[model samples]
Target: MANIRFHPNHDLLSHYACGELESASSIMISAHLDLCPHCRQKLASIEAEQASELEKSEPAALSPSLNAMMMEIMAQDCVDIPVLDEAPASQLALEDKAYPLPSILQRHNDKIGPWSRLPGNIKRAQVDVSGDSQMNFIYMDSDSALPEHTHQGQEITLVLAGEFYDENGTYQPGDFIVQTEKHKHLPRTRDGQDCLCLTLLNAPLHFTSGLATLLNPFSQLFFRR
Candidate 1:
């Protein structure tokens, strides 16, 4: 992902490395780690540091009886390790179009719901990642746009395929974007480009400007499946 312009911050990555994030958020970061070499390297460094600290910590001495018990267990015949069955690659299909999912998402294939229509030219497939937040696969058709909106809480979007642009800049595959209440922008693709994104929203989006404002009342559609 050479074109990736956005990424999870160090604090978020640190939390992910520490296994301190919620399951849904952890999956999001794990998928991003698959796409991002830089973040992967950073996470590796963080893990190494944590491992070093653990190694440096003093361990209590074991009693002779406990040590003898451990030795007796180790002396027993070892059982064979079971080989895991390899699963076929997973793909997300919409009509005739299909997109390969990241490894982390592939593991959750059963959790993905069917695609449903949304306002504008957008379509959404809810991902049943259990948490207080909502996760979805948001598909934007070519030349289509979502109305300008700001977040009620926090919103995170990771580009899975194609490209999209906002008032700020264009986002390519592997780009990790975060939005707060202070930001308001329309997200859309160019004439020949459609986009598939994985989005995690902690709260409903507040549609801004014109007729889109009326949509604010129904914003729960984005929050709920």
Candidate 2:
């Protein structure tokens, strides 16, 4: 059993299985599922429940126009759409090291931007997903710390490698943490332990500490394209 301390709630998992979650949130959930067997089993259960419910529901009658359009489309030449292989021989690189990405993100490997250094001993690479939200791969070097901050809207962070600690507790790989304006904390790694995380932010972070407050103006740089 994987010791995953954090996980997406049942509602979020249901939404993810049903394809109802936003793109950014869906990516986070997918990454977490890659590392969490518990969540994988939970998701399978949810999917089975959904299938049972769908089986019990009565089918609705299609409109005459919709039925005619569907018939016309079906009568036309059957075109075989080529299916692209989802597995790619690619890796997410940090410095000289390369890490295998989650299966869901493999297709978007090209959309990841080059890494840029941050004020702290952190490096960030943005993922270009079609949505209002922002997704990033945040790499924290050993003994590094992010400025104390809170989210303006919502922030989801999933540990990809190593471990990090905030005032709340320590987070290992597969931990799915959600934060909003109501939560504030500083994330850091100890000596000899580096950390990498996939983060999705709906809004810019609000730095609240003394010197870190000065970084509020530059917070947009973290999320902006």
Strongest candidate by lDDT:
1
Error of 2 at 167 (Å): 0.7
Q: What lDDT is reached at residue 221 by model 2?
A: 83
RMSD of each: 3.2, 4.1
Q: Provide the lDDT at 67 for model 1.
A: 67
Tens-digit lDDT string for candidate 2 (1-225):
276899999999999999998888888898888889999999999999999897566234667888688668767997899997666646889887788787888877989999998868999999998888999999999999998888899999999889999999999988999999999999999999999899998999998886879878887885678
Q: Candidate 2, clashing residue pairs?
A: none
Candidate 1, residues 61-91: lDDT per residue as tens digits? 6678886886688689989999999688799
The number of clashing residue pairs in each candidate reads 0, 0
Error of 1 at 224 (Å): 2.4
- Model 2, runs deviating above 4 Å: 60-89
The count of backbone overlaps in candidate 2 is 0
